[model samples]
Target chain A: DVKVTQSSRYLVKRTGEKVFLECVQDMDHENMFWYRQDPGLGLRLIYFSYDVKMKEKGDIPEGYSVSREKKERFSLILESASTNQTSMYLCASSSVKGGYKEQYFGPGTRLTVT
Target chain B: SQQGEEDPQALSIQEGENATMNCSYKTSINNLQWYRQNSGRGLVHLILIRSNEREKHSGRLRVTLDTSKKSSSLLITASRAADTASYFCATFIIQGAQKLVFGQGTRLTINP
Candidate 1:
């Protein structure tokens, strides 16, 4: 079974503080992604990593950065957390071995910036 | 970027009734997928229909993709109370690299 776990289910941070969200996948998937879900905006991709040490900016990557130093783990970084950055952060992984298939997601981290 | 737009932002129906949700995309896609997310939880992939395929099914879930019109529909038969969740339609763009664009999602409430 494919399992993805996030570091925290709920997190709170003050404005201008640095925040780090971690995600780990049991399966050796090559693709990992970070997304933020909001009320009416839906899910917006923040960043994606296809391989270790490689990253790509997604639609809403302005205040967020990502790191994939290891194959099994990915991290999302917020240099200066702000009130607007508070949202439900989700992590996902996909494998390219069989073909282009659906992505498996983690339980998600609800971050609140006060 | 958001490519798909789901119709009827919210739906309320009784259990045992069939629920249908529609999604329309703006560009060419390689495939369309349906995902369900429970309250404050991550999304679970339900079904994926390739651009060439018109329809596919799994359990009580049925998905249809219309490449020409860039539209898709998800039909859940005999809905159960546990089926209450948000349904999102994601599209794999032809030019997108292993990334899928998601819609705003439809909130489904099943009343028993």
Candidate 2:
């Protein structure tokens, strides 16, 4: 079975504070993604990494950035946390073998920016 | 922007009844996938249907895709209370490098 684990299940940060959310996958997948889920917006992609030290911006990449220094780890960074940035952050990973393969997701981190 | 939109944003049904959710997309897709998320948890991959395929099933879940209308439907037969969750349909567009665009999802409730 594939396992994706997030660094924190819940987090709280003050305004303008820096925040980091980490994700690790054991399946050795080549593709990793970061997304923020809101009530009406669903899962909007923030950033994704296809390989080590490689990143791509998703639809809603503003106010957020990501890092993929190693194969198993992906980190999402918030330069200045704001109340509007509070949401359920999800991490997912998928293998690149298939054209369109299933993505395994980690238990989301509910971030509260106050 | 979201490429898919699910209909009947919320649904309620008794146990043993079937639950159906519809998703419609705006663009061509290489494949469409369905995911289930329990409250406060991440999504679980349920099923995937390619653009060339019309329907596929796994255990109690049935998925149908219509490329002409750019729509898909997921049916859960004999839904149990444990089946209660949010169902989201995501499209894998070819433009991006296997990036998935997801819909708002339909929240399902099954009463015992």
Candidate 1 TM-score to native:
0.97
Off by over 4 Å in 1: B96-98
Per-model DockQ against the true two-chain complex? 0.87, 0.91
Model 1 / residue B56 / CA error / Å: 0.3
Q: Write the per-residue lDDT of candidate 1 for residues B1-112, one digit (tens) a residue.
A: 3589998799999999999999999888888889999999999999999988999999999998888888999999999999999999999887756479999999999999
* Tens-digit lDDT string for candidate 2 (B5-76): 998899999999999999999888999999999999999999999999999999999999999999999999
Ten contiguous residues with the weakest lDDT in model 1 chain B: B91-100
Candidate 2 deviant stretches above 4 angstroms: B96-98
What lDDT score goes with residue A27 in model 2?
93
- lDDT tens digits by residue: candidate 1, A1-114: 899999999999999999999999999999999999999999999999889999999999999888899999999999999999989999999998977768999999999999
Chain B TM-score, candidate 2? 0.96
Clashes of 1: 0
Go through the candidates in order and give each one's C-alpha lDDT. 0.94, 0.94
First chain TM-score, candidate 2: 0.97
| Tens-digit per-residue lDDT, A5-95, candidate 2 | 9999999999999999999999989999999999989999999999999999998899998889999999999999999999999999999
